[model samples]
Target: MLAKAFYPTEYKKQKENSWIRVCVRFLLLITLGVPSNTLGSFQITDDISKLSVLKQNIPRDYNISVSYVPKELAGMCWVKLNIYYLEESLNELAKKFGNVSSNKNDIKILIDMLQDMRLPLGHLDPIMYDFECHFRNEQWQTEQYFDYVKDLLKAAEDNISDDCDPPPCPTTLPTGKGFDVI
Candidate 1:
């Protein structure tokens, strides 16, 4: 007589099983302590940590020559390496999310994390300035050296733009920039 009587027992069993599956999934999520809303943030945080590690591994004594690449370039190189890793991580996140622009809040969180990480590197500004001055004067040694310097300069510019307001900037190296070769 009731609507329930119209459905077969098999249909009712399937409905109950689906509800059980949903409940199990919800419980698992809660037990894992990963709130659904903060999952993206956790992924972003993990990526930032990995970037920090990569930045730390850059050789502090990295120098080409006393006359060409100064010892100060080591710090600048670290900054460049950081930017490159950050860009790669962001790209991977973008791919995972598929159209990250729509998720403005996630983008903001990522940018905030990046800015915080870069805060300590602010002290390197004087070194960067000296590099820029030398760059403008064509003081670098070879064509490869000049391209490498340009790549570093491009990375620096990308870093500055990323620290600005919303909409994370694109990281573009100069034409001949080699990956990790510097």
Candidate 2:
């Protein structure tokens, strides 16, 4: 046949390369359509800044109710809950995927974000007092409280639809596709 008579190995290699190039182009086309404006960064909820909720939820008595906590404080309560949840999730991920997995990167990023969010020593009293009475019930370890930060970061990452900035606009298009880039 024509294939056997010609440079067959070179032809086969060319075909393989074409397939890879096509696949890459197709993936770029699909992902590129997602606009930059639609993307958002991973960050804490803005509910903490609402003065009205803070006024209402700031405890005036020794007894506190976690259910009535403001959104910002509720963010903390969720962080507390997530510490245990993430520990368990990581255990499960380890069991399924062995020690190394994609989730490990996510875990590391979460840990870094949590450390950044840590409350300063000076402002810890009222927050800790309310957290202990309303959220912890009895008493929670300081280490455990800090550990919850990983969960907060993970949650924020999950909440963000587009964690990274949109890819740069495509500057060139293949001549055969007859595509124009503006």
Whose lDDT is greatest here? 1
Q: Give each model's clash number.
A: 0, 0
Q: Residue 42 in candidate 2 has what lDDT?
A: 42
**Model 2 C-alpha lDDT per residue in residues 1-182, reported as the tens digit of each score:** 35556588989999999999999999998877553223543444332233233223333332211112222434534443333334433343234433464434444444344343432112433433444323222222323322333335555445522122222333453243222221
Find the 10 residues in a row with the least total lDDT in model 2. Answer: 62-71
lDDT (Cα atoms) of all candidates against the true structure: 0.40, 0.38
What local lDDT score does residue 84 receive in model 1, on the 0 to 100 scale?
33
- Misplaced by over 4 Å in model 1 are 1-44, 47-76, 80-101, 133-182
Lowest lDDT 10-mer window, candidate 1? Answer: 161-170
Clashes of 2: 0
Mind giving the per-residue lDDT tens digits that candidate 1 earns over 1-182? 55755458889999999999999999997788663223322123343333333223333342222122222433435442343334333344334444534433343455455454455445644544434422211122233332343344344444432222112222552234222122
